[model samples]
Structures are given as structure tokens and as C-alpha cells.
Target: MQHIVTLLIAIVIFGMIIGIHEFGHFIVAKLHKIQVNQFAIGMGPRILHFQKGETEYSLRLFPIGGFCSMEGEDESSDNPNAFEKKAIWRRMTVVLAGAIMNIILGFLLIAVLLCTSQKVPSTVIAQFAQTTDATTGETITAAESERSGLQVGDKIIAIDGSHIFSTTDLIYKLQTTDAKSFSVTVKRDGEKITIDPVTFHNDNTEGLLDFAVQGKSKNPVTVLSYAAKDTVATAKLIWMSLIELVSGKYSLQDLSGPVGTVSVIEQAASTGENVLERVQSVLNLTIFITVNVGVFNLLPIPGLDGSRFVFLLIEAVRRKPIPKEREAMVHFIGMAALFLLMILVTVQDVSRFFQ
Candidate 1:
């Protein structure tokens, strides 16, 4: 019964995000006077559906993803307000609405988390990984209390001379960084100080401060910011992390697929001290997965939203859509490639499960 409930909750949460994304497209298309043929929350065979006023709203059986089918997305339609008939700007809005919705939802979630009193980790370094801020990077910890290294109570004052107040800002600083080491200033135990290191503290690149923030509160906290902060930061992290794949930062051993996620779910259920913890774990897992989905979709490969947007941009520039046949072929090839890639990832996932 517990497993069943967990699965149902997962489905609802995942489905809701996908539904919101598709709904964004559906609503905007309607606003622009475009005709939406179908608005679907999921893919494959329809589990339930109804149509009203030129739009068919359907709930499909699968919970993996969803779509909004609008007329003339590919070519011009005779209808005056159909997608193809609209100006390029309107079409771009309609096309980009799904991603925008995902970002909005992420922000909404963060806001909710903040309202609940979860302390979001700001740019402050709560604690370095077993090291002090004054002498953390390249200097060993495990010895003294008066050390100046990033410890469990340091608040990051600046990154490379830029002020950082929130997790979002810290993440943005991370993405644009090409510098070998970050010159970080911190507020440690209420005293202002500067810390320099041979590297920044993250994986793909070197960080000057090798530290983790320690939250005063015990619960998982989400920090909200203006300008789609969580989505952008999360996206940047994933892309940067992927780069590490070639540099031996990530190995097959670290990769996990669907089955692996389920394992975590089950483990949380068994290990959690209480129901709230279990549920929190599930929420955290869901957020992680969805953020990954948001980012992964942006990969500029065929059959992905990123690639589709790239194509749309080309169409906008040329003032002509690509031939449907060519687009379809590209998607077909992309599907095959992705399917093979999934198989490999799944294999990696399974191997890790047994190990």
C-alpha cells in the first residue's frame, strides 16, 4: 500500500508539471487566437478525453511527458490566427511557453518552500568539506579551531569580487566563471574575511572555496528569487556537470536510471525516521528529476525542445518553416539515437543497482 501510494503521488506530481507546461502552450495559443487541435497531458493512447469549442483536452495513459497540438506549428494555416498565420514573435511565445512554464513552476515551488520556513542555503559557506575558510583550499583541516578556512558557519560575502546573497546568485556566478580560482570573501561567525584557494569547490571546475553551507534549520529549504533563478541555476549545473563526463568527473558507476530512482524511493521509505521525512525525500527526488528534465530537454539535439527551438529560430530568421519531411526525418534520427543512449544509461543504472 505504501509503495502504491508513493507511485500514485509520483505520478500526480510529475503529471502536474508536464500538464502545466502543456497548458501554458494551450492557453497562449488560445490567447493569440490560434486554434489548438488537442491539449494533452501525457503521450501514447488516451486514457480519458473531451473536446469543447475546437479543442480536445485529453489525459493519456503515460506520465512521462505531454504536448499541446496547435494548428500550423509547422506550416501556414488558412485560419487567420492559427500558429502559422501569427507573427514570428507570437509563434515564438507559443513555442517557448512550455519551458517558461517549467521555470515558473520551479520558482513557485521555491517560493512555497521559503514560505514554509525552510532555510535556503545562501551564498554563505556554512562549512567547508572538513576544512576551514582561512586556510581551507590546498590546506588540510582535521587539526584546528581557529583556522580561517570555510567552516560550518561562513556566509559568502562575495564571489570573485561580486556580491552573492542567494543560492541563485552563487549558481549564476558559477556558470559564467572561466577563472581558475574564485576569490571569495565570507562572513564567518560574524566576522568579515577573505579566502583564496587553488580551486572553487565544485566538480567540473576548480573552486577557490571548497565548502558546504550548513543550514541552521534541519529541513530541506528552497530559496526563491526573481528571474527564474532555480531553473536557470539548475540548468547551468547540469550542463556543467555533463562536461565533466569527458574529464572523468563522472563515470558509469555514478549514473543511475529509473530503476535506481525507485530504489532510492524504497530505501527512503524504509530508512526514514518518520512519514514526513519519507515524503520530504520523495519531494526532493521529484524536484531533482524534474529539474533534470527541464535541463535535459534543452540539449540541442534533434527531437528535443532545445533543438526544436533552434529550428524555430531558423524559421523565424528565414521567414519560412522547414519542410515537414525534413523535420520529421531529423526527429526520427534523434529518436533512434536517444533510444540507444537510453539503453546505455539504463544499462549503467542496472549495473550500479547490483553493485
Candidate 2:
């Protein structure tokens, strides 16, 4: 029964995220006066469909993907309202709108989490951990965090110039950065102060700043500011993760497809000490996956929105569009390769359960 519930939650989450993405394209295309032939909730054979004027809206068999099929989206068309006949700027807007919508949705969800989560941690330094002397292996009662002008009441505003809203924000920036020193900004006694070149004993395995912190009071400005920075941070994290994968820091096994993603959702939905924790777990997963979708779609890979946008960029640069047939062939081949990759990944996901 628990598994069934988890599955339903997974379906709802994915449906909302991807459906909003397709809707972005559909609405933008319609506003630009492009002829949208279909607006589909999924791919493959249509399970349920209906026509409203010229457009056929469909719920397809598969829930893994969807599309907004505008006239001349994949081919040349005689209709002036066809997508290909639109101005380059208009076409670019349509191509990029889906990812933009996903990103917007991610921020909105985070704001919801921030406003509602009672346990959301903050960057304000409630206290500092006693540092240890390296040679003596004894606690240094007076540490550099204070000696360098960091105080107990200081509210961390930024680290290395990136805005810091919560303790998670500070930790994320610190973990991802390689610098031995950072410029830290804090609010002390109602005044903003910058502590430049604050040195850290970075071991690369743990957080840089030595402090015990708590969540800020639910200040509207603070919450909204945190949400904005956290959104940008999440996007950056996704990009860095892809770079790590390409550089062999992460293996293929680290990747997840729909099956593995659902498994994660199951874990989040089930593994909480109480009802509130469980709810927070689900909300966190939703934010992560939606932001990830936005980032993934923005990658300049063939058969993806990013690649289509790139082709448009090329057209803009050359002041002439690429031949539609050749462009379509590129996307077709890319789609085939992507399908093969998905099959392999899905098999791997299933195999993990047995192992």
C-alpha cells in the first residue's frame, strides 16, 4: 500500500513538472500566432485525444515525455502561421520557454518550501564550534572565526560574494569552492561588514566554516532572498555535476533515469520520523527534480530543447536558417541515440534492485 502511494506521488510530481514545461511552449507559440497542431501530455500513441479548433490535445500512452507540436516545427510548411515562418526571435522564445518555465516553477516551489518549513536552517551564526590545534590535537578555545572578526551574533550575508541565505547555502558554496580563503560578509549590530581573506583549514571532505547555526525567523524579505539565491545555487550545482560526470569524477552508475528517480521519491516519501518530515522530504525532492529538469533541458545536446535553441542561434548569427530537412535529420539521429541510452539506463536501474 505504501509503495502504491509512493508511485502515485511520483506520477503527480513528474506530470506537473513536465506538463508545465510543455504548456510553456504551447502558450508561447499560440501567443506568437504560430499554428500549434497538437499539445500532448505524453509521447507515443495517443491514449485519449480531443480537437479544439485546429489543435488536437492528447494524453498519450507514455508519461515519460511530451511535446507541443506546432506546424512546421519539424518540417517546412506553406502556412504563414507555421513555426518556421515566425521571426527568429519569436522562434527562439518558443524553443527556450519550456526550460524557462521549469526554472520558474522550481523557484516558486522553493519559495513555498521556505515559507512553510519550520526547520529551514539559516546562515546566521548562533554559535561557533571550538577549533582544534593541529599539532597539539587539543581544542583551541579562541579560534580564528572570532579572531578574524566573525562574532556569534553575526548574520552571514554572503560568502565569496555569492549571497548566503541559509546554513545550507553557506555549506554548499564552501563545499563547491576550492579557494583556501574567502571574503565573508555578515550583518553585525545592524551594520553590514565584509571580512576579506578569511582563511580556512579546508580538508575537502567537510564544511569549511566552523559554526553551529539555526534557521532564521520567518522574515518575508529574508525568506524571499534565500529562495532566489538557493534557486541559482541549485542550477549551478546541476551544471557542476554534469561537468564532474564528463571528467570521470562520477560514473554512469551515479546517473538516474525514471526508474531510479521514482525509487528516490519512494525513499523520500517513506523515510521520515514524522508526518512533517515526510512532507518536507517530498517537497525537497520536487524542487530538486524540477530544477534538474530545467538544467538538463538547457544543455546543448542534440534532440533536446538546448540543441534546437543552438540551431536558432546559428541561424541568428548567419542571418539565414539551416535547411529544415538537414536540421530534422540531426534531431532524428539524436533522438534515436537518446532512446538507446534511456533503455540502457532503465535496465541498469532495474538491475540495481536485484543487486
Candidate 3:
């Protein structure tokens, strides 16, 4: 029963995200006087559909993804309002709208979470923990912070010159960094101070940092500021993760598809100390996934919005668009490659469950 409920929830959430994405393109195309032949909420055979004048709205059988099919999107047309006949800038806007909407929705959701939740961590140091050595099991006494020139009430401004707006920013950089020593900048006595050569005793432990961060209060200014910072932090984390993947720091096995994402959502929604905690966990997951989706769509890979923009740039530079047939063929091949990749990742995700 729980599994069924989780699946239902996943479908609803995924449907909404994908529907909003398609709506962005559909609405933008309409604004530009382009003909949208169909606006679909999912892929595969249509379960339900209705034609309202020029556009057909559909609810398809699969919950995987959706699309907005514009007239002359992939071919030449004589109609003035056809996508290919429109101004190049207008077409670019229509193509770019989907990812922009996803990013907007992600930030809006994060704002909601910030206003309602009290779990956000701040940059001010609250206390320090006495960490134990992983190998020796020896408890290190307090004063690591004191000895390292860190003090309570100090506001962490940056780590290794990267601005630290919140604890989320701090943790993301720390976890991904391979440096042995780093510099810390803090605000103390209304003056900026730098502590260099700060070394973390990373004796094969889960966490290297020895300090506990203060939690922010649910105030208007605090919520708004932290919300913006958190959103940027999440986006940066997504960008860094992609870079790491391309650099061979991560493998295909580390990648997750829709199945893996759904499983994560299920786990997050199901595991919490209380009702509010569970809701907050789900909200956090939503923020992460939505932001991730938005950023991924902006990558300059064939069959993506960024790739379309790249072609437009080429058109601008060459004073002529690529041949429609050739462009369509490239996108078709890209789509096939993406389809195969998704299948492989989904299979890996399912196998993890059995293991």
C-alpha cells in the first residue's frame, strides 16, 4: 500500500513538473503567434485529448515526460505563424521557455519551504563536536576550534575564497573538495579576518568538519535571504556534479534515472521524526530535483534546449539556418542516444532494489 501511494505521489509530482515545462513552451509559442498543434502531459498513446480551436490538449498513457508540438517545428511551412516562419529570436524564446519555467518553479518552491520550515542552517558557529579518530577510536578533546582560531559568534564569510552564504554552501564545497588545506574567512568584531592553512583531520570519517552550525529563525528577511542562497547553492551543486561526472570522478553507475529519483522521493517522504519533518524532507527533495532538471536541460547536448540555442547562434553567425532535414536528423539521433541511456540507467536503478 505504501509502495502504491509512493508511486502515485511520484506520478503526480513528475506530471506537474513536466506539464509546467511544456506549458512554458506552449504559452510562449502562442504569444509569438506560432501554431501549437498539440500540448501533451505525457508520452505514448493518448488516454484523453481535446481539441480547442487550433491546439489539441492531451493526457497520454505514460507518466515519463511531455511535449509541446509546434507547427513547422522541424520543417519549413508557408504559414506566417508557423514556428519556422517566425523571427529567430521569437523561436529561441519559445524553445528556452521550458527550462526557464522549471527554474522559476524551483525557486518558488524553495521560497515556500523557507517560509514554512525551521531546519535551515546558518553560517554562524553554534558549537563544536569532539570527534573521535576512526582508526584509533580515541576521543579528541575540545579546543580544535579555539586552536584553529575559530570562535563562537564568528560568522563564516567564505571557505577558500568561495563565498559562504549559509551552512549548505559550506557543506557542498567541503564534501566535493579534494584539498588537504583550505582558508577560512570570517567576520568578527565587525571586521573581516582570514584563517589560512586550516586543516581538517579527515581520518576516514564521514564528516571532516568539527563544528555545529546555528539554525536560522523563521523571520521574513532571514527566510528570503537564505532561500536565495540555498537555491543558488543547489544549482551550483548540480553544476559541480556534472563537471565531476565528465572528469571521470564519477561513473555511469553513480548516475540515477527516474526510477532512482522516485525511490529517493519515497524514502525521503517516508522517513522523518515527525509529520512536519517528513513534509520538510519531501520539500527539500523537490527543490533539489526541480533545480537539477532545470540545469540539466540547459546543457549544450543535442535534443536539449541549450543545443537548440547553439544552432540559433550558428544561424546568426552564418546568416542562414542549418538545413531543416539535417538539423532534424541530428536531434533524432540525439534522442535515440538519450533513450538508450535512460533504459540502461533505469535497469541499474531497478537492480539496486533487488540487491
RMSD of 3: 3.6
Q: Candidate 2, which ten residues in sequence have the lowest lDDT sum?
A: 199-208
Give Cα distance to truth, residue 101, candidate 3, Å.
1.3
> Could you give candidate 2's per-residue lDDT for residues 281-316 as a string of tens digits?
898888888888888888888889999999999999
- Candidates sorted by TM-score, descending order? 3, 2, 1
Please estimate how well model 2 matches the true structure, expressed as its whole-model Cα lDDT: 0.83
Off by over 4 Å in 2: 119-121, 130-150, 154-168, 173-210
Question: What is the per-residue lDDT of model 3 for residues 150-247, given as tens digits with 9 covering 90 to 100?
Answer: 88888989889888866668888777789877798999989999998776543334356767778877777777777788778888888889999999
Pick the winner on lDDT between candidates 1 and 2. Answer: 2
> In angstroms, what RMSD does candidate 2 have relative to the true structure?
4.2
Show pairs that collide, candidate 3.
none
Model 1 stretches with alpha carbons more than 4 Å out: 118-121, 125-146, 149-154, 157-183, 187-194, 198-232, 246-248, 251-253, 267-272, 347-355
Supply candidate 3's per-residue lDDT for 171.
Answer: 84
